[model samples]
Target: MASSKSVLHIITELGRGGAEHMLYKLLSAMDGNLANHHVLSLGSGGPYAEKIRALGIPVHELGMRMGRPNPMLLLRLRGLVRKLNPDLVHGWMYHGILAARLAAQGRPVVAGIRHSIYKLSSEKFATRLVIRAVASLSPSLAALTYNAHLSLDQHRNIGFSSKKACVIPNGFDPDRLRPDPKVGARLRAELGVQPDVFVVLHAARFHPMKDHKGLLQAIARIKDRNMVFLLAGTQVDSGNPALSGIQDDRVYLLGERDDIADLMTAADCLVNSSWSEAFPNVLGEAMACGLPAIATDVGESAAVLGGTGLVVPPRDPEALAKALVQMKDMPQEQRIDLGKRARQRVIETFSLSKVASDYLASIKMFWMPTAGDGPKDVQEKEFLVHVRNRGVYQLAGRSGWGRADFAHHDRCGAPSWPR
Candidate 1:
């Protein structure tokens, strides 16, 4: 019998990124009757892992080697599935999707494609081979934006069928992301920024794809002395060369931070300089916190921002700088109104509850087991772990035995397990 309440989510890591954050929100808001969730991280867990665990969700860290796929990882994952016996296995990102599909040979699987295929290109044959494998194995795939879905359709290598592919925009938990005024004040004061300064905030991973150089150049062009730029993201290497020797009192690099909501609220506008994105979560989060954004017209950024903020051409520093200046000179009342509109847009379109409900509905409609395909009784022996720390003396000098053996001896009656 199908429980319709069990799902296992597999991801490459639990780092602070858009896709990982989306998964966190979805898992947090999952319907109690419709889904019980577990997570498996291919890499070591990070800050978000503790948050998930606090929700009483089981999170397993595989600590697998990065950059290269190991066949042993698949075997370990398959064993994990057998032990957990979840009704559905959902994969996020390319590597996780491929591993999930391979492990779920006889089970239902759903893969999330979080980026546009147009953005995915590699000169290496091995990378292409892995992409082809993922395309071939995923039974159902989802894209986070309309443009992402369209991009998938355009790629010959990613043979995601139209009927099996769906677009589900990333959603946010507004309560967890509420802005803190005091924190914002302290942050500005610590940075020596004046109360009247116009701050432009850019929050993204410091990867080449984010086009941080373009953003820095744009900041250099903005002649306004009262305007300051705050860049918050992970520094990939020693430091970004584009940001080198460009130290002015106006530019600040606040590397990987925990209080993003405060930074977003403190800023006059959020800037996105990415060359590509599937659905920029920072854009949505900043908007939700009542901040207008200036993003390059790439990926689904324009779609996410809607008409609430200005959109510029990617890689054109001059155009971005011009937009920044325009926003800086705009009336305070109009800016506030624009921020209000942005928040309203997020509330209307991208609530976490709505996203979880949609995912549940889709599962029920497509992957629900039929009469002949009903789930079988999972053996308890497959999930047993020995308790070595017994308070008293050991029994019969044996450490442990499988549940089947215990059942045969009537140690545990009938060995019934949850379906």
Candidate 2:
């Protein structure tokens, strides 16, 4: 067999986030023999830096602070890339995507977009600038990956190419996240929750995008004292001034905990009120823990639910409250069946092994030479054709390349790639 290729991963930061967690898990599940992997964090490495290093992977940091743009860091990154001379560069988020292209120095780069682009007006000034910059640079990327289809469509509408892009939803570890009735019962008892009380969980960091206020209002509308709401995530504690609007005594704020699976098992269902997301990992985790969910129709939440639970419009407190009531009104047997189906969907389509394999395959597709290269397998040739034909430019009402672009061929009989 040929020797493994060198691949460098670049991310904006190593902070606690769904994208950061997914990267850590993907690296852990990927086969080292396939490629030599190294990570470069553009900002201070957070909790994940040590975790990734513990896996025997080299983790480098630029020590750049968040919300501060530094051009010199790009020069340093280029110098580091020149020293490493990786065969491929994989970028994680918006900042990393732009940095990867600039630092790769013509090497193949695969861009990873983890956040949804619902509206440019809704993003911060710095983020909007970065998004437009990446959109202009999107065509040059060898390939791009999105965590949700909604992100892909939203980006494509704003001049990003969808030809060489694909959506690979976040994966879950079923073995560690599965349901346990006994554990759930004990947790409920410890939390002073009665068996008859209906528990609703909202698991996401306290961010404006998360729309915690909307969820709180929805919970407030529900007068059912037996229905309890558990809020768990970063800064989601009793002291948060943002949560002071809550007047419900049944609401429990669990700042942040390591065991989210246990929290899921203890709840009858999960609730997401975020106005923006690419793919919410908590929903998948809840489903894996055999709990139904009621998520806003943001990003891929509804698709992720797959009808196993409920979906409401984002920022609509009335709709969210109604969905909560609907979930509470369900028969015990029916809810159990929905939770079972939720777990089955996750196991069948979004297992860790499966998503990791998809990432590996997409990386290899861009890394390998194609068309005019030496003899190629049918699969490789087909992939190139697909990539070539799918390269689209929709900005300014420009339709993609014409059939004439693919009419000509090289010796391999495959259509020549668009210039």
Find the candidate with the highest TM-score and give its number: 2
Q: Over the stretch 1-419, how does candidate 2's per-residue lDDT look in tens digits?
A: 42468889999999889988999999999898888889999998688998999999999999888688788988999999999999889999999999899999978888999998778888889888888999999877877778765687788878887656656678888888899989889999999999999999999889999999999889888988889999999999978998866678889999887778898989999999999887899989998999999988887787778778888999999999999999999999999999999998888767888778767876765556656664234334535554444432111111111222445445423233333
What lDDT score belongs to each candidate, Candidate 1 first?
Answer: 0.69, 0.82
lDDT of 1 by residue, 1-419 (tens): 32556888888888887778878877778755566789999998787787788878899988886677778877888999999987778888777787787777566676776766553463246656767777665434422112242344444345644333445667777776655667777888988887888889998888777998888888888778988888888873236565656667787878888878889868889999988776788988998888899998876677677689999999999999999999999999999899988887777767676666766665543344345433422211111211111111111112111112222211222121111
- Model 1 clashing residue pairs (backbone): none
TM-score of 1: 0.82
Counting only residues 3 or more apart in sequence or on different chains, how many pairs clash (N, Cα, C under 3 Å) in candidate 1?
0
* Candidate 2 weakest lDDT stretch, 10 residues: 392-401
